[model samples]
Target: MKKLFTIFVAAAAISAAAHATTAFTDAKDAVDYRQSAFTMIRHNTGDIGEMLQGKVPFDAKRVQQRTDALAALAPLPWPAFSTPGTESGGGDAKPEIWADFKDFTAKADKFQLDAKALQTAAQSGDQAKIKAAFAAFRGNCKACHDKYKAD
Candidate 1:
């Protein structure tokens, strides 16, 4: 029992140390992770948009799959605005993030709603409905990026 307790304590200390070291210390690291996630969502969303616009042939199965993927990406955790001496991948995040956190969160929630609506429209297979919802989805993207995202 004594030996087992000692081994457990050592393992716990190592795990804690690793976790502390892996925590993001700078805005850049956080932003990098966010950008990677965004890229994945963007790729999937763009594919859906193309199908919706009829620029690409519509594939219900593909649309459903991509829509599900994009919808899954909603409600990203808003990142901290700035850390001393930390750059956010040349990000255009204004200081307003901290100053206007409530507004930022609201927009994030709106994005989730818009994404869900788009997914529903795509699944419904109504061309007109998909077009309208896709436009709304695109508008939400622009609005959020305009206000919150860095250039």
Candidate 2:
């Protein structure tokens, strides 16, 4: 029974790894995955921005919802960027993304950290704190886009 359980666990681990790899099976698949993630991030962040700018009412529940969504979406695209041929997948992602991979990763880390901070602030139900956190998060986004994304 012990041996059988070990084999089952090994198989489950392998299947999980395979599932992760299968997410970016080809260049186009990688690009599409990344683009879709970014699209979702943009939509969620846009709603947050609208609330921040007074274009929409500041609802604690909605702010939490949007920021939580952004936190979840933030890390999904980076792995897709690792697929070969994704550097020039007819997207606005600059080639420097790969050439300066370390810097890109650092920027991505900053963005993720800020995103989490925003999420935490939103969870506190404090509008001013959320606004401050969002401003910091937006700076991270703009810094990365300015360096890595093409117009």
Candidate 3:
């Protein structure tokens, strides 16, 4: 019975995610969703960065929370970028992204991988591991932005 209940919950969650992925009816809607996701990502990233840099004292639980958020949010924006007409939605994204989508996706895949790595490091509660993983994860942003994002 518990197994059946767990399966049912998983099914429901999948249904909800499907609904969300299809909720955007236009470029603007897609852009809005993606921007929202990025905002959350930035907030969590900022907190983690601050803690790591000694601007804020390290809080293990908070670091884990932020890393977990980063891992979950990292994958949310890519699909929206692929949404039809998102190019015209007038965000910071540059045309180079669409021109070389393959490259952009590769960078995005790296970003997600780094986010997961940071999450794992945070989970292990090792400050040294977190610092190294965070550096790699944060570097992914600048590399992508230098080519794909507008000033």
Segments of candidate 3 deviating more than 4 angstroms: 1-24
RMSD each, Å: 4.6, 4.7, 5.9
CA lDDT of every candidate: 0.72, 0.87, 0.92
Q: Which residue pairs show backbone clashes in model 3?
A: none
> On residues 6-51, what C-alpha lDDT tens digit does candidate 2 reach at each position?
9999999999987776537577778878889989998998899998
* Candidate 3 TM-score to native: 0.84
TM per prediction: 0.72, 0.83, 0.84
Which of candidates 1 and 3 is the stronger one according to lDDT? 3
TM accuracy, model 1: 0.72
Candidate 3 global CA lDDT score: 0.92
Candidate 3 local lDDT, 1-151, one digit each (tens) = 9999999999999999877766265788788888899899999999999998999999999999999999999999998888888899978989999999999999999999999999999999999999999999999989999999998
Q: What is the descending lDDT order?
A: 3, 2, 1
lDDT of 3 at 3: 100
lDDT preference between candidates 2 and 3, better one? 3
